[model samples]
Target chain A: MQQPIAILDSGVGGLTVAKEVMRQLPREKIIYFGDTARTPYGPRPAQEVIRFTQEIVDYLLKFSPKMIVIACNTATAFALETIRSRVSIPVIGVVHPGARAAINRTQSGYIGVIGTEGTVNSGAYEQALKQLSPHVDVVSVACPRFVPLVERGNFRSEETYNTVNESLAGLRSTRIDTLILGCTHYPFLAETISDVMGGQIALISSAEETARDISTILHDKGKLARGDLLPVHQFCCSGDPQMFKMIAQQWLNEQIELTPIVWQVPHIG
Target chain B: MQQPIAILDSGVGGLTVAKEVMRQLPREKIIYFGDTARTPYGPRPAQEVIRFTQEIVDYLLKFSPKMIVIACNTATAFALETIRSRVSIPVIGVVHPGARAAINRTQSGYIGVIGTEGTVNSGAYEQALKQLSPHVDVVSVACPRFVPLVERGNFRSEETYNTVNESLAGLRSTRIDTLILGCTHYPFLAETISDVMGGQIALISSAEETARDISTILHDKGKLARGDLLPVHQFCCSGDPQMFKMIAQQWLNEQIELTPIVWQVPHIG
Candidate 1:
């Protein structure tokens, strides 16, 4: 049996990453977990977010995956290092990949980042960017409203356009040549964001960049899956199965096997 | 002492990769080698190219670099696996990175590759791309004359434009949406190539993509350089140091320390 790449998120935001992985590495199997019952870890305290992420990772680890991807920006911000220390396999976070890509794409040395409250508060993008190239200038904003908009599947609605336009108004005044969609959920509203940001500023999707990093790291380790047969993928969600299935099917454009998990400990959910 | 990333090429082509590494990972040190004495490994036999690459690897090993980058497409096509097996360090090649980037950029399944005689003949890009995504349609062309023009530092001459236009006349007929600049030297003539191919096709630079992979792989291994100290890079060439220095400074946009190598054995040079 081929070992799968396990991915986890606060909620369906990670589906953005999962979709890219499916497109980029079609042969690799995936086991994904979305804690939709406790969705939007953005406003939660760092410790709580870490605990929630740990619970999801523990659930995903049962499959003995080759690699673990922390696909949500908030979870990656709070729990990535904690999980990295505990896991034996490679644990990738969304923040650094997005930061590296922004550094690669930015021409003015000025980069703008929009993420959840937790990710922006943790200053992960800023730290990651400065760590890679110290001279880079980073502008970060927390979009607390964006996640709820994405969770409801209101991607290109007029409400989304208004929210995106107003949210990015501060950035437009700045001279940033590249804007990193620091939150995975942000990609869901990318078209609206692009319409507001216009053509001059390039948007860097963390989901797409994370998938590219996954390819690079896997290829480097000589661990990329190989075979003519396509591997079947499995997904799990801790929430309303109907809504998760609807959103996932629409976004992935394919049928997927989803296993809804009931929390054994009622206190967590 | 910060261990440098050792990069080698048949000639000045590898400087493109080195320049990107400098821009993306400013803290990391680099030691580069150019076998200008026996330049243009494109038309050489596979065995001869492998032997020359192995020699450069043996020479570079003395520095105990953190990683080795075979920055020439011809050498990467011929000798990457041979060098990887011999060395314990992470060995990066230009071929896979370019292929990966092309896979990421191509909206259309059809991809174009232009390389030297050896790289194109070896079918390395086709193999890499097909290995990653089996459905991609690859159109490969061997541009044997492009390298000599670059080596002579004849970048934008009228003669260069005609040569580039005539060489890529065949590719213009294809419906490929993405073209991989399979040769590292090709980026030097990117303007002419882009002018010929037009904006509909995206040009994937192996040099830039290789640097991105270097960053990803190094970060994954927890080997990225830290602290604010700028790294001083070193360069060496087997042939005319004057010409090499001139091209290196002009391309890199900074003064670099160059050491001319005198071959101990007459057979190699």
Candidate 2:
């Protein structure tokens, strides 16, 4: 039996990553958890977000996954290192892959990043970029409003476009040749974001880049699943099973086995 | 006291990878070996190519590099596993990175690969692609003439264009939406190859992708150089030093420290 790659997110945003992982590594099994009971870990305190992420990881660990992907930018910003120390298996975060890709794509040395408030406040992307190349200039913004829209499945609406346009107005003026969609939820609104940013600025999707990194790391370790048999994937959510199922199916374009977990953190919601 | 990344190729072809590693990971130092005395490893027998690559790896090991990059496609196709087993450090190759990039870019599932006779005959790219996804259709062609042109320092002449155009005619006719510049030497001729293949096909350069992989692997290992000092790189070749120095400076757009090594292999050249 192939050990699954476990993925966890604050909400539906991580479906973007799951979709790409499936597309890129078709043979690998996946087990995903969404903390919809307390969605939008973006605006929460760092400690709270880290605690929630640890809980989800602990729950996912029951299946003995080969790798854990922190698909949420906010959680990756706050909780990646702590989780890395706690887990023996390889744990990947979305931030560095996005940052590395932005560094690769940017010709002007100026990069723009848009993420959740928590992630922006953490300055993860900036740290990751400058750590790799000190000469890079980073511009970061917090888009606290975008995640709710994505969670509600309000993609492509006029409100979505207007919000995206107004939110990115400051970034549009910069001479940034590359923009990193620093949040996993951001890719759901990529068309709107692309329309606002125009054709010149290359948008780096953390979801796509993270999946590619997963492939690279797994291939290096000789852990990639080699069997030809199709692997079954499992999806779990902490709240509102119907809404989670609806959005996940529409986003993933397939039916998923979703198990709705009772909220274990009683004080949060 | 920084441990440099050791990159070796059959000739100056590996300079493509070296230049990218410099651009993307500016903080890291590099020690590069180009076996120019007996280059064009494409037409050689697999065992001979393996022995030559092992020799280069043994020579490069003297630098105590943190990682070994088999930057030539033919050498990677023939000798990566052997080198990896022989060396305790991480061993990276050009093929898998290019294959991964091609897989990421190809929407039509039809991919084209052009390399020297050895890489094409080894079927490494097809195997890598199909191993990841069983559905991709691969079109492989061996361009036996492109390497000598690059080695001779002839990049943008009309003769170069005609040679590139003629060599890729069969590939241009295919439905491939992505083409892998399978040989590290191929990127020097990218503009002409792009012109021949047109804009519809996305070109995947192994050099750039390999550099990105190097970053990913190094970051994961917690061994990325942290100092702010400007890294001085060293380049060595086993053949004509003048032509090698001229081409290296021209392609890298910077003056490089070059050393000429007396040819150690008496039987080949």
Winning model by DockQ:
2
**Model 2: residues >4 Å from true position, as ranges?**
A260-269, B260-269
Which 10-residue window of candidate 2 chain A scores lowest in summed lDDT? Answer: A260-269
lDDT of 2 at A250: 96
Model 1, B156-246: lDDT tens digits are: 9999999999999999999899999999999999999999999889999999999999999999999999968898888988888888888
Clashing pairs in 2: none
Give the DockQ of candidate 1. Answer: 0.79
List the TM values for chain B, per candidate.
0.98, 0.97
Clashing pairs in 1: none
lDDT for model 1: 0.91
- Once fitted onto the true fold, the runs of candidate 1 whose alpha carbons sit more than 4 angstroms away are A260-268, B261-267
Per-residue lDDT of A93-138 in model 2, one digit per residue for the tens? 9999999899889999999999999999999999999999999999
Alpha carbon deviation, residue A191, candidate 1 (Å): 0.8
Our model 1 lands, by Cα RMSD against the true structure, at 1.5
